[model samples]
Target: MLTHLALKDFAVVQSAELAFGPGLTVISGETGAGKSLLVDALGLLSGLRADSGVVRHGASRAELVAEFSLADAQPATDWLRENALDEDGDDGRHCQVRRVVRADGGSRTWINGRPVTVGQLAELASHLVEIHGQHEHQALLSRPSQLALLDAYARNDAERRAVAEAAGRWSDLLAERERLTAQGDVSDRIGWLEHQHAELERETLDADSLAQLSIDHRRSAHAAGLLEACERAFAVMDGDEGPSITRALRQARDTLQRVAEHEPRLNEVDTMLDNAAIQLDEAAVLLDRIRGDLDLDPQALEALEQRMGRLHELARKHRVTPEQLAAKRDEIATELEALRGADERLQGLDADIAAATRAWQAAAEVLGATRRDAARRLSSDTSALIAELGMGGGAFDVVLEVLETVRPDPQGAERVEFMVAANPGQPPRPLRKVASGGELSRISLAIEVAALGLDAVPTMVFDEVDSGIGGAVADIVGQKLRALGERRQVLCVTHLPQVAAQGHAHYRVSKSASDGVTQSEVQALGAKQRQDELARMLGGVEMTREARAAARRLLSDAG
Candidate 1:
């Protein structure tokens, strides 16, 4: 339950701290007394969008904080844990939400003093409190909200889950079928893949073979020039005209060897010259072997050229470099395999889709049946409640219409509409179109009282629920609000003294101005003070003796 609200520099409320308790808390005052400002502050703390205009004239920022005791709120506790916003080491019985809005239009929010995103704050607040007023009544007029309310009251969890599961399966199967059909329609692409595969296959190319072929092609391309160069080198090193340089070196080495006994340096020079002559003879033999090996084969050259050209052409066709051609080929092969087996896969998907459709239909039928049963009970209960609220001869009904085909949705195929007949002998019509504001409030109150146990939120606020009604009707409205308070904390902003007298706690809002600034203040009233306020409400600006007597009687009767 919401335990306390602390607001500062927010609208006309410069600073205020209000403590709340269980049961009906009524806020009553004249119009423009900032009663709605308090609600707006609570809304801001509950993660509603903040407005800079809410900041007071002199304050740079406005702060709103709400403290909720979660000792009985298991759903909210679980939600906090799930979102990792649980307080550490502290008892799990309390949660605090704080919101701050700067005068410059910037806003920040916190949960238990820890910073949190506004979205997270909103999510957490949803499980803790429900604000139902004129705005919510407008929302209830929507068909979607009508359907949801019916489902909630019906407690059709298992049926809803079954429909959800079936819908998910059907959606998955449809996606798979689409994918398989797309793949199977690519038969024309298979021919192109085959052509690419054949082109690579004819080459029979391997890394080692390609390397050797490239080497041979380069050597063969320059064979004539290479042979001529080698021949010239060999002739220079070992020509047979007067023994050439080798013979001259050998002769000089022999003469030096004979004078080695007279000079050791001469012997070293002779040894070096002999080594040079031997190296020259070895070079001539190597040159002769290289010249013999040199062969210029045009056939091999033409084959290498054709192979390179084909590689380049394939690379361009595939929009890839030659090095990536292998990877591209593997990808295409995989795609071709999928296309070839698409028919079988698509058949499997069709069977799955059929099974899913049957499952969805069965679940939807079960849900529709449950809704019909629930609608009967709900209509009887709401009709009784409406009569109790001073609406004589009013008939409330829940109209459930089933779609022709099963729709893939968790909420099933039934469309629910709240139909009502406001007066005797009048035909029932959609609640939104037929009910006046006053009638709508009464109907909403009846539905809320009926579905109180189904709701998880601990606190419910009703603003202007007594609009357009008075006398006995207002007394009945107060009775219903008081009864709702027994199950959940109800805060009603009302103008009727009868309703205010019925409150477990009463607060009176009054506006005052000083130094050209206006502000509103709320004070919780005691029994005597409540009677005085009730008298004031009965007789505006002045409380007459008869009005005080009536107010006293109203309070006594309310007790």
Candidate 2:
């Protein structure tokens, strides 16, 4: 329920604070007294668009705050918790929504004093209150909103859950089918994969084989040059001409040994020469062994080249580097395995689709049955209400048309349309086409009152719902509004004294000017004051004796 509304510089409402309570609270005054300004302020606080023109002439900005008590609003509390906007408190349950519009055409919204986006505020406000008026009635004309309203009234939580689950399962199965189907012909791909696997298996190039092949290829590629270089080195190290450096170093060492007694440095030089001669001899032997091992194998080199060429070709065909060939091979192998199982997977998907279809059909059948039953009851109840509201001969019907294609949706395949016949023996037609503005208001009120018994919103506002009719009709509307107040907070703005007389609390909007600035103020009316206000409503600017007497009678009858 809306507990308090604080307005500052909003339109003609310069600065006003109105505290609201439970039951039917009516706002009444003469025309152009800025009664609608109060509704506009509440609208802004309820997440409606804000206009900069609403700011007072001398003020820089306009502010509107609406506070709601959420003690009985468990659905709203759960919604807040789901959105991570739940307030933290052990003292009590309450939620406050505030909106501020700057004179520069900028606005900001807040919930529980925490900054929030306009969309978030709107989402939260939608669950808190619903405003009905001449212009707002179009919300009911939408088909989707109508269906949602019906579903809300039915409270079909189980069926709704079933539909959602079936939709998710169907989506998942369809996605998997698409993925497997994109793999193309399994037989052809598997054959191609087998051929590639065979080719790689035949070559089987291990690390040792690769290393040996590289060595043999290098030797074969440079066979003549290597042999010539080895011969030249061997000859230089051990060829005749004085028995080479070995004999010369031996002779020098013997002479140095004899002179070592006189000069020890000569012994060191002779030792170095002997080591050099031994190293040369070892080099000659190594060169001889290398020359012997240098037989070129052309066949081995050709095989190595062929293997490397095939690897390169495969790399190019796969659009990968040679190093990635192994990984590509593994990926292709896995794909082939999956391809081999595609038929089984497809069969499994077919089963899943069938299962989902059956599940959806069952849930839809149950939902359709429930809606039909509820619609019958709703139509009869609304017809009774319509008769009570002074449309005695009117007939109301809730027509349900089942769609052929049963797509899984939160609200089944039922299309609900309200039909009406204003007189007996006349065929019923769509309510929007058959009802006038005033009749539509009454019909909407009837449906709202019936639906209100099921909806969870804590507050309901009707902006002149009692318009275009008076006397007993206005009284009946007031009675229904008061009856609705028994379950939820009801706020009504009206011009009818009959309706105003039924209010548990009354507020009067009056315009006043001070210092050349006009503003609107709202004050709660006392008993005598309400009598005068209702009398004025009955007799215009002057309260006549007859008008006062009629106002008193209306109030007495309302009580």
Candidate 3:
């Protein structure tokens, strides 16, 4: 339950703070006193959109903070802890949500003073509060929402989810089966795949071999030039002609040896000349070996070029890199295997889809039966309650239509709509078509009260639930709301005295103006103040003695 709400510079509410407890808390005020502004403030705390339009004049931004105690909200507490947003409080039993809207229309959110995304705030708020706008009842106009409401009332959530899962599985298998069937003939597909696989199999496309082939082809293409270059260099270095480097170095070493007897430095020079001669000889031998290894055969060169050309041609045809041809071959082979087994797989999918369809149908039947039972009771109870709220002899019904679906659907196979007839002999029609605005509100109130057993929301807020009714009928509306408050925290914003008198707590909104600036203030009324406020609501602006007495009697009877 909400323990506290604080608003800063929000709308006509310049600044306000209120502490709430579990019960029916009522907000009442005179015309244009901004009673609904309090509800709007609460709405902002529950992740509603905020903008500068809601900010007070001359203020930089609007701020809202709502505090919830987790003593009875284990689910919300667990959610906070799981999300790592429960950082400030030690016991993990307190949650504080705050939102700030700047004048530029940008907003920031926080949970337990730690910055968070607006989505996170919205998600966590679901476990904390349910803020029903005056038009939330308009959701009944949608068929999907009607179906969801029925399931909620039936309390068949587990069964409905199971049916959805089974239906999804069935739909997936059916799609797969249809795709395979569209392939026309498995025999033709397998024959095509096999032919492609055989064509790729005739050539080897290994990465390392392809690279080596390219290298060898380059060498073969220039084999004659390479051999000629090496031979020319070898002839220049070690030729039989006059004054070769080897012959000169040998003569120099002989002359140096003769002079070595006269000078020790001459011996070192002779040693260096000998080392140069040995290195030149070894280099000449390597040159000869290289010339011998060169492939000078034109046929071999032509064959290597033809092999490379074939690989390139195949690559262009397949639209892939030469190295990827191997992978493509493997892929084709796998598809061939699949086509060979297509008939077997089709049989398996058919069996699985059949089983899934049976499971879904069974669950849908059970869910439909439960809904039928719950709907009758709900419609009867809500219809009977509406008579006391000024709609005498009205009738309400839940129209559940079974549908024939080509394929299984997630929401089981039915459409639901709420129908109503206001007069005794009138035929029932769709609620949206038959009910007026005020009647919609009242009927919505009736359904909300009747479906209390199914509402898991911790808090329920009703804005002007007593919209159209008055006199003795207003009293019945108040009593029903107070009874609902007995189970969950109920907050109501109303202008009716009877409704205000029935609240466990009452707040009065009064507007004040200074310097042509208007602001709304909310005051939680004490016993005497509540009596006076109820009197004002009962007897207009006058609040005569009889009104006060009657107000006190209403409060007493409510208690």
Highest lDDT model number: 3
Question: Candidate 3 on 58-86: residue-level lDDT in tens?
Answer: 89999999888777667688889899887
lDDT of 2: 0.79
Q: For model 1, state the Cα shift of residue 169 in Å.
A: 2.3
TM-score of each: 0.67, 0.69, 0.68
Across 1-559, the per-residue lDDT of candidate 1 in tens digits comes to: 9999888988888888889999999999989998867777767776788879999888999999999999768888998888778888866789999999999989999998889999888778777776656553344577886777678788998898888888888988898888777664666787877887777666635566657767877787788889888877766666543457877787788777887899878877877887887788788788888899987788877877777788778889889876677777778778878777777778888888888999898888898898999889889999988887777899999999877764477678878999998778989999878546667777878878877646667887777778877898889889889889988898888898888888999988888997999988889898899999999988887999998999999988888
The RMSD (Cα, Å) of candidate 1 is: 8.5
Cα lDDT tens digits for candidate 2, 1-559 = 8899899888888788888898989999877888867767767776777777888887999989988888867777777788767778733378888888999989999888889999888778767776766554344555665666677777787887787787778778878988988876778778999888666556544556656766767787787799988877666555443355666677888888887999878878977888898887887788888899887777766876877788778879878766666667778778778888898999899898888878877887788877787788788888999887877899888889887774565467678888888667889988767546567667777877777646666777778777778878888999998888887888888999988998999999998888888778899899999999999999988889999999999889888
How much lDDT does each candidate structure score?
Answer: 0.82, 0.79, 0.83
Question: Candidate 3 local accuracy as lDDT?
Answer: 0.83
List where candidate 2 sits over 4 angstroms from the true fold: 89-92, 186-340, 420-437, 526-528, 538-557
Clashing pairs in 3: none
Off by over 4 Å in 3: 1-23, 31-137, 185-193, 228-293, 339-353, 380-384, 387-395, 421-427, 434-439, 453-463, 467-476, 483-489, 509-528, 544-559
TM-score-based ranking: 2, 3, 1
Using lDDT as the measure, name the better of candidate 1 and candidate 3: 3
Query: CA shift at 40, candidate 3, in angstroms?
Result: 8.9
